[model samples]
Target: MTPLHQQICQACMPDSSPVMDDQRASLMSQLPGWQCLLQDNIWQLKKSYRFSNYSQAMAFANQVAELAEQMRHHPALLIEWGRVDVYWWTHCIANLHYNDFIMAAKTDQLNVNSG
Candidate 1:
């Protein structure tokens, strides 16, 4: 299978189903330091990225924002002094979708390229 980061996100329909458990597990394995959790009854993929200082964190957040804009898929980003928490989910589907995995992988790639 192609790496999630290499995959492009497609528009998700409101009636589309969430990714299956086995598929979720397989995709999750490709993203290190990422955690899957149920928040407010919704499953989201989350990760905390550490940086040296606020400026660095902000820079990372900007990069993520640019990527999100490019893909037209956004994440919940919590920027802090030295860390940024990112959460990925498909709002239209009210659940996790393949796009979440792809974005998560792209986020990881951004982190790698930034540093």
Candidate 2:
């Protein structure tokens, strides 16, 4: 994975706390690759994208890494045989920050073209 500092887009942090409904809508619209899974206090975005082979999976991983680096946001990426799983969270807030989900959404957007 690329470095966190390089992946973050520090300038675009939304100014308001998106209402719950808005948050969900944003997630739905922007992050198609990620499935919303609510944990204790965090919103996790996960998905498994198929690949033709190991190299394709590795390419996707590299793509995600680049995006993460550019956004200065990082997701835990688990690379299995032919798929990758990503876990996203914001530790600073102790719960899911709106930005975390936003980044998740954007990352999904990035993956759309990669596939």
- TM-scores of all predicted structures: 0.98, 0.67
lDDT for each residue of candidate 2 in 44-115, tens digit (9 for 90 to 100): 666777777788788888888887786677788888778877777654444455556666656666566776
Candidate 2 regions exceeding 4 Å error are 1-8, 11-22
Error of 2 at 115 (Å): 3.3
Q: lDDT (0-100) at residue 52 of candidate 1?
A: 99
Overall local distance difference test of candidate 1: 0.96
Give the alpha carbon lDDT tens digit for every residue of 4-114 in model 1.
Answer: 899999998999889999999988889999999999999999999999999999999999999999999999999999999999999998799999999999999999999
Which one wins on TM-score? Answer: 1
